[model samples]
Target chain A: MTLHNKVRQARTQLGLTQSELGVKVSVTRQTVAFIEKGEFAPSVALALRLAKALNTPINELFWLEETAQ
Target chain B: MKQFFSIKSPLWQILAATLLYVVVLLITYDKQHSTAEGFTPARIGMFVAAALAILYSIIYTMAITRYNKRNPHDKLSITGVKPAEIRDEDEGMRMITARATERVYRYHSFALPLSMVFIALSDASAYGVSTILFILTLGHYLTFWRGVWPAFRETSEE
Candidate 1:
């Protein structure tokens, strides 16, 4: 799945609000919104932070099309 | 968000169409103009317009398009570009950039000597249009190179 579900899923799992996730990821909540909507891609650095904050490995947090293909 | 278009296709189309327009304008100039001076002003204007459009395209691609691409610095994003063994990848970019500069410099440096022939044979309007076209194309490359150097090519250097 894309980042929308991923962000919502992760946020719920951690019981974090958008603002809290933003604080954890060191981005603005609006930036988090864009990422969740797949309008913007987070940098590799930010992705690692998000994965760490959610207590999940990076791969589970993101799925490549190549995997399905 | 609501709409999207392929980036490179439109630019390549524009380049091809502009070249064709220039060729057609050249062929039709004498038939359309009783005096070469009459053709000079508009030809120069078209050249300027084309040049500006090209420059705008490059700048838009570099700066505006960045938000759309996965951040190269982010490690966890799907499309994020990992910084590998290369520390300060821009140094690699500099080396490649130096090589590219050498190539472009050599190619464009011979331009004046070649175009000097046109200076004598060309009508004033023809000369003006030609010079404007050259200036605009050159300016586009100068801006394009600066933007590309810091972004794409720089990130993937040797």
Candidate 2:
């Protein structure tokens, strides 16, 4: 029922902290933290921005586990 | 004058207001306990304290307005635009606050009926118990969301 993301992995892989990612996406660091923890789902605009910031495709970054089939 | 009034710190402002409310409540209780005396000093003190509390709320509203203008687009503007401000604006905190609000709403739904039952069966002052519970619940949510939750996030980062 929720979207899962590899935000933390991608953020770390790019040598970026949560704050840095949030800054790039015009969001708060805690938002980045929640999104990574699967506690909050990001809007499409935010997802795309996050992908661009991490230099990854949106699909690779976020997915719905329940709808994987 | 403007600078002094607009020196915004939301958590402290809320705490001050809560303290003022408690003072007013205590003064009223004292007046009621000695009601045989017509319009005692405590009765006057209660009105004065209540008036001060109302003034404090007006000041707080003004402070919030000034702060929000100074830091437009910043969600935690009342605390100013510091690096730690990010914690207050975090989506996680917002989500947690939303969940807490929902829980508090449900708590009130059950608590109201239970309180009515207790009041009917006892000599407890309905107004006193209701006021205390309201303040406690409000203080808990405000402190957690505005003070503790954000501080916890900021500390974890360090």
Candidate 3:
């Protein structure tokens, strides 16, 4: 299973750049970029903070994708 | 001076350092082989310091390559990016680095013993081998540690 998130969507919706979102959540722009690209999974605490930053719920922000067998 | 340094990329910094290291190593080797002087603490210290610098440059090169590949367009001066940023921005990168480092450690575990056997059998300097290995192992560990350390930090502050 892979974790997918709507961080980019939400950030754009809020008119926030990756760097801006990262600042809101106390991370670097690269971190935000990675999160958006689904290359990196955030810790629970970070996920919660990210959700709060993007004004979305934890479940709405991130969900598990079922991989092919 | 800030702009002066920024003009040269991390790649350049590494190339320059490595080139200098080679020259120094050659000089040291020539001195040892040609001179009748015995091994001294000062000589060992000079080699150790030089080796450490080269190892640091190598690590810097890896980090710069990764950062440039990730960021693109913009240039980050050699000292600009923090280890936390590298770890934080790329989960895939961290995983890849961790896996590669582990593989090196595993190989070294076997290679080190073999090296010891070779050292004993041949005229290899045990002190030199030990020093090089110590610096190399420490550098690898430091690279990984710097990456993970921020994960344990409190999330309250940036």
lDDT of each: 0.52, 0.64, 0.61
Distance from true position, residue B49, model 1, in Å?
9.0
Ranking by TM-score: 2, 3, 1
lDDT tens digits, residue span B26-60, model 3: 55665666554665554665676677677767776
Residue A43 alpha-carbon offset, candidate 2, angstroms: 2.1
What does candidate 1's lDDT look like per residue over A1-66, in tens digits?
334338668877778876688778766455565466565566678788888888888888766553
Flag the better candidate by lDDT, 2 or 3: 2
Q: In model 1, what lDDT does residue B88 have?
A: 28
lDDT tens per residue, model 2, A1-69: 568889999999999887888889988676777788886888788888899999999999998766645
DockQ of 1: 0.03
**What's the TM-score of chain B for every model shown?**
0.37, 0.52, 0.38
- The deviation in Å at residue B134 for candidate 1 is 5.0
Off by over 4 Å in 1: A1-69, B1-63, B66-68, B72-89, B122-158
Candidate 3 chain B has its poorest 10 consecutive residues by lDDT at B2-11
Model 1 score (lDDT): 0.52
Best by TM-score: 2
- The per-prediction CA RMSD against the true structure, in angstroms, equals 14.1, 6.9, 10.1
Over B23-131, each residue of candidate 2 has an lDDT whose tens digit, in order, gives 7566657846775666676677776777777787677657667666776775344344442212345455556556655655666677667766766777667356656
Interface RMSD for each candidate model? 14.7, 3.3, 8.5
- Regions more than 4 Å wrong, model 3: B1-104, B117-158
Model 3, residue B51: what's the lDDT? 77
